[model samples]
Target chain A: MGLLVVFGQIYDPAINAAALAFDRALRADLPDGVIETVPTFRSVLVRFDPLEISCPRLEGHLQELLARQDWLQAEPDDAAQHWVLPCVYGGARGPDLGKVADLMGRREDQVVAAHAAVELRVAMLGFSPGLAYLGQLPEAWNLARRSTLTPEVPAGSVLVAVRQTVLPATPIPTGWHAIGQTPFRAFVPAHRRPFLLAPGDRLRFEPVAEPCYAAFDQADFLRKSGG
Target chain B: MSGLEILSIAANATIQDAGRPGFLRYGLSAGGAVDPYALAEGQALLGNAPDDAALEFAGAGGRFLARSDVWLATSGAEMTLTVNGDARPWRQSFGLRAGDELRLGPPQTGVYAYLHVAGGFQTEQVLGSRSTHLRAGLGTVPRPGIVLPFRADLPHSQQPLKLPRPGSFSRRCFRVLPAPQADLFSAETRQRFLAQEFRIGQMRDRMGMRLEVEGSAAFQAETGLSIASDATNLGDVQITGDGTPVVLLVERGSAGGYPRLVTVISADLAALAQVPSGELIRFQEISRDDAVVELRKYRREINTLKDLVQPVFRDPHQISGLSGMNLIGGVIRGDEEDNHDDD
Candidate 1:
């Protein structure tokens, strides 16, 4: 059985901070039968082995941990890793760039500038393997996902919607608008550490021309922790 | 140095083991053989480690040429097997010499089948497992001209053995426990779900399977259908916007927003996986204690399969697809007579 600890009704950085802190604490001093913990936008899902521990008992233990802190006001973890990756925006690489710019009532270059202006936090890794959802973009950037899916988006495609940015390591169908393409590889199964960015890791994108982005050795860039 | 060379293969054939758990936080699901009971039975027959990797074939298996003398065991979804162009019985261990061709045909009843080698397949481990997660691009799919390696140094003196085939392939009634959002579904809706005989839909895969309920009135939650996307569990029966019920499987996503009405218990998931598309199925509500007790009993049953392995008493008629081969005494003679009649 799994226990979900939800902090709020909607997405909030403060709630995410509390959830991440709680996740770390639980992992550091795990309860018996606690298989794993997954932190998301405003909640943490603690999966436990039902055979080893009953749901009520696990719930009581989590209640005690929840009462230990005012997680809503807790500061974000300082140990979170930061990365700045090179991205190519508004071209054939990202077919929906023009559409997204038009929706925002801004030029393509302005959209790119606005996207690269802010640092985002990796709220969660989900939907697909190594797909990170980085979020809390300014309210002005909040946009709805496409009514129909784009059918397929290549790996390293940077997607934005609902005040969040998503980076996929493999081809997938998405409702989000493809704003740019990144040279960095977010997931490499052959590497010792397959997933490059953890849930709480912070990241920023540096806009680069298509020609310069093509010269990068993706594996090498990932090894250097983003060049 | 011992291995098997793929002569021809169908799509979706790959190496799998018990699966990689504890990685769901990274958006990766535990992707193992859909029919894990079959995997266990084959491993028991060959005396391999519990987590030893084996070939998981979806629908149909392929033709393989043994690169060296090796013992092989087949289990799950009774399929047609032929060694060196001679019909062989499924669910039994047999030996193949260097350059012997082993062919596997389409399954007769179930959707998944397992093939086991003496020492297990020596494939490179990714994230502590050999199970292929196709959505994650974690492992390579077995294709023609690829060589699956295994340990040749191990002793190969074990006798040919067979176990009773799994009975779960035909199972239609699966027991389910309440999911986190079960309360959102009213008593009437829950009762309707139990009363309904749902047919498996055509859109099925490792990720999830959609169940087709009768008529346009699918089970609807009076309290709306959308929930904040939270971590999802395997076997979760999630209700989509159109009121369709989808049971998430081994390769399910880590998180989803749909309201989950119930979750099938772990003990019956393997059985549910074998139930082919277009088949009728029903769900039975089970309490938490009952589900735990059932799971324990299922694990014990699987653990004791090794004791049930017995020497194969040749019964060509009892086995399907054996009509083409010549029938002799209880024992059959072939070019490799000594190895074929181990008893």
Candidate 2:
């Protein structure tokens, strides 16, 4: 059995640049049998088939690849599908908006502006199937996750937590602040590729009035076709 | 016509064959018999194929009235078996006449027991298996009035049942292979895992078993990694953010994000499946080669046992003499005093 060696520190939260660089380097050197590699703010998970390659072998391969440092650090790929998600930001649609604005010491409109201003990147899709974690929320809107989790949140609920935005793909429990609700469904099981959003995709939240929200809701545009 | 009619069906009675394997890539777990060894043993006793379907009774067993004469065998933890109020020996095949009542009591020792008919239970194969996936709602349970079909052509012989050597089913040590993320823990934490005996927590089922590791050590870093949700198989021990160890089982989700610490070997997985709550469990790390060797030994033993029972059909003369003596021991005799306790 060959050795599969993994390089880099176990997990470090501060340096996203180092994590991204290491991900690219590992991909360039070891492409075969690398089913998928998911990079987070701190660490990376490289998965492979155990039958095809033993853990020791994979570990050794990683160690050698890291030592050589032959791979170049490429820029983040900009080729991503952009999606404009329509959302109702206040009232029943956004129950936590006032609370979040109070926590941030900003008005409701300013909180909405901060949320919609930045172009969020889909860092990863995990925690549940099709749940995409979008990151780099505006500095003013950065907030910690709720102290306790809500029993259950409906699917398509748009939440914000720790400088990131999450478009839930399923009916899952969460501790994040549900700042708004989206009429655009991000995941549809019936589609050829169920998740409309991918790890590298970009999202822009477009605010809508209550009347427009009602129209979108009545039209059922959020529900996937044939869903 | 040959069939077995249900007199009383237990709460969790369901048909199971050798589980559906090699489907993890498609987001499906291999769901099958809770106790594969007992299921295979029941088939071997009746000279049936290893993959034949059988009724897996959980916690409590059921009652059945034989509609026609048929050969059947029962195996797993010493459960009481009765034929028309008379006790019948277990782990052995015997003939049941029409209108004969067969009753099974609660397990005296183990968690699951298997009942195998000479002709395998007839059920539609779904996704390449006759196994019932309760979570997926794929197969219907045996109802009280349901009639199950059997093969009429099966040759009947009154051979002495071969009983397995009795072994204690109490607390036992399990062997495991170190997981991919095993190195993530400090050397002391790893040592603690080997030295400390953890109790099986209350949260356990077909999906996973939660182990209570008292006085938890700082196992993994506070900062976590976002691992891509990939295939998670049986015996894979995953550690959550809170440092609790959860061993995934037969019906576990196809993928997960938690860091895995170890994967128990295939040979020891059966032992892990039957471990009840509050039972003490400890892990012993073994090499992958050793694990494969142990698995081979178990398979060889079963194959040898199957061959031992195959010759009775060809030599009918040997069984005919023993049939007259009534091989069924522990049967209640004609004592009116003994019948009073039953009421």
Highest DockQ model number:
1
lDDT of 2 at B144: 90
Model 2: per-residue Cα lDDT over B1-343, one tens digit each? 4778887888777888886664343334567886677777788888788888888876678889888777788876657899888786677767676777899898776667788888788776666677776654445468798877777787433353555633525636888887766776666777777777888887876677898877666356334555533346468888877788888877776557676777887667766766667778898989876765776776676677776552122233543553354432212222322322322
lDDT of 2 by residue, A1-227 (tens): 11223223322223333445566667777746555555544445565544456656777777675666532243455656677778888677677889899999989999998898788876656555456677777666568889998887766777987778888766667898888887766655344544566555678888888777657742254343232
Taking the tens digit of each residue's C-alpha lDDT, what string does model 1 give over A34-148? 9989888778989888878887889899999999988888877798889988999977888888998888899999989999999999888888888898976888788988999
* Proportion of native contacts kept per candidate: 0.67, 0.01
Best by TM-score: 1
RMSD of each: 3.9, 8.8
Looking at model 2 chain B, which ten-residue stretch has the lowest summed lDDT? Answer: B328-337
TM-score of each: 0.92, 0.62
Positional deviation of residue B34's Cα in model 1 after best superposition, in angstroms = 1.4
What C-alpha lDDT, on a 0 to 100 scale, does residue A2 get in candidate 2?
A: 17
